[model samples]
Target: MKKHLILLLLWAVVGVSARAQKPATVTIPKNKYGLQVVSSTALYQQLVEQNPDQELVELATYIPGLVLDIKYATPDNLVKEPVYTMATAYARKPVADALKKIQEELKPLGLGLKIYDGYRPYHVTELFFKKVKKKAYVANPKNGSRHNRGCAMDLTLITLKDGKELEMPTPYDATVKQSHPDYPHVSEQVKKNRALLINTMQRHGFTVFHNEWWHYDFNEWPKYPLMDIRFEDLKAMKN
Candidate 1:
């Protein structure tokens, strides 16, 4: 009887822990953003295309104004990006929801999200690995990437009034140390703006990777799946 009672108590404690974890839990839906905090499962379907293996390519449901990414476009692979500036969100819902909150908080200041990339195909990740080495900003295709997992994003800030990419210390995939947000030569205003973005993201539910100014992940990233589904496969699924 004592053993059974102990097991019951342990079960009760486990149940309570799970409830506490829900607030921080993240879900992976078709193309929605935010690492966790997903409360639904109505996934956006990927449009299928004819492939060698009779597979399909899938894409996330894009919020209006955002363009599907073309840099990595190929029947072999497809990358999608959210529209910049207008707040026609490009990230998955959890990410979108988080951005929406930031928008509400930053709109009065004339600031907004200028997304460049999201939902990277594993093939593109491999392409980066093939071109860029594993030092600093570079990643290894064999090891896997956060973007491939759909939990990471490459982004920057912009003004709704003028659609220009903000002046950051370095360009995307820049391998130089000068690109670090803390580079001494970078203006204090830029640093301040970077900090505001980082802090705001952290406060809302993200953890910033110190080396990269624009990279952040939901605290629950480990729970998500690492996907290598090619754009072609996604397209084939759509059919």
Candidate 2:
């Protein structure tokens, strides 16, 4: 009888320890197309803790003199409505570190970086698809965007002294052929500026999105999973 009682106590302790060791399960509802997203803040925090390299590092914090002109935070974007609640930009640690180096290189030339968007939540991409209805410009919700994984950035070059943006192929989110990096009709000055931006970003481990001159994706974007955690939740996690 004493042996049986001891076995029961040991079993109970083992069960408790097993439960405690289990990682928190993040439960984001699968989309209509059966795509899973990481929506739980706790799960996101757990991920950052487990893999510090994949943590979504704030860009403004790491890149000195970086300017943020988040168009989606205002009603200036294609949707003509504010989609993001905050004007913050985030990227994976390695991507952010690469941008830091890019910023240093640009500083000597009297130029800086102005960010339009980064690390968008998965739900925002879904909404963009619904509103646009154009498969070419918007990311299909079935496969989330690189931005959802914190590996994509929409940015342009800016003059450091005046904080004015350099002339680019086209405005942000413009669905036009001129936005293409290879478009040949732009003036010499525009071409030069666009080339400078793209070459600099490329030298720092980023590749410009074929459709958008200002959009760039980190080489490791495919390694991260789709995340739906909101900026407010991320801010709270930092605090």
Candidate 3:
């Protein structure tokens, strides 16, 4: 009878373990009209569990002979440089598709998008506000932000032929008058590249924020939800 009692105890323990292992879901109180927030702890697992027939963004436009890596390119595990990567589907599938469409349009001109920022978390948004003042180029963390919703992105133009960056007048995060729209003394190339980005993204249904040259929000961003989920969660969701 001792063996029977032990088996009963073992079964009880397994029952409790199974109950405890249930995944938790984070319920978002609200989401933007065009965008949906991904707040659930189980979101990553849920996305991967499905055999969704998702399309990889069509990459029809390749720089004829360009090895077009961005400033974020990392040399190796040694951490020699920053890592360059294309935006993945989990965060903003539409944005990824937009990039592909932009690439297709610009292939003839030998230009490509060199993305600097996309799908930023609230934590990163807070950090950004700390570094840059709000008057000129600002991203407030308290209220809604594009990066928070994964509906906005910042990018610049690069030569598709040699993969070298073009002249943007100022580098990323400059936040000065030169980066302003009315700062007329800049080169025509700067304006042209900026316009190219604006027109292309707008064609693909993105709304441009006038103050900043590189900033864009999807027209459908209101349908998406805010995502506090980290980079790891995004990767997990992609699988």
Task: Give the winner by lDDT.
Answer: 2
Query: TM-scores of the models, in the given order?
Result: 0.60, 0.87, 0.65
Q: Considering TM-score, which of the candidate structures 1 and 3 is the better prediction for this target?
A: 3
The whole-model C-alpha lDDT of candidate 3 against the native structure comes to 0.59
**Candidates arranged by TM-score, highest first:** 2, 3, 1
Report the lDDT tens digits of candidate 1 across residue range 46-137.
11111121111122343323223233332222213321222211233465556557666766777766555555555555566555453567
Off by over 4 Å in 2: 1-31
Cα RMSD for candidates in order = 10.8, 5.1, 11.2
What is the lDDT for 105 in model 3? 84
Clashes of 1: 26
**Measured by TM-score, how close is model 2 to the native structure?**
0.87
Off by over 4 Å in 1: 1-92, 230-239
| All candidates in order of lDDT, best leading | 2, 3, 1
lDDT of 3 by residue, 151-235 (tens): 7776677777677777776776565667754467877978777767778888998877766666788777765555666655555
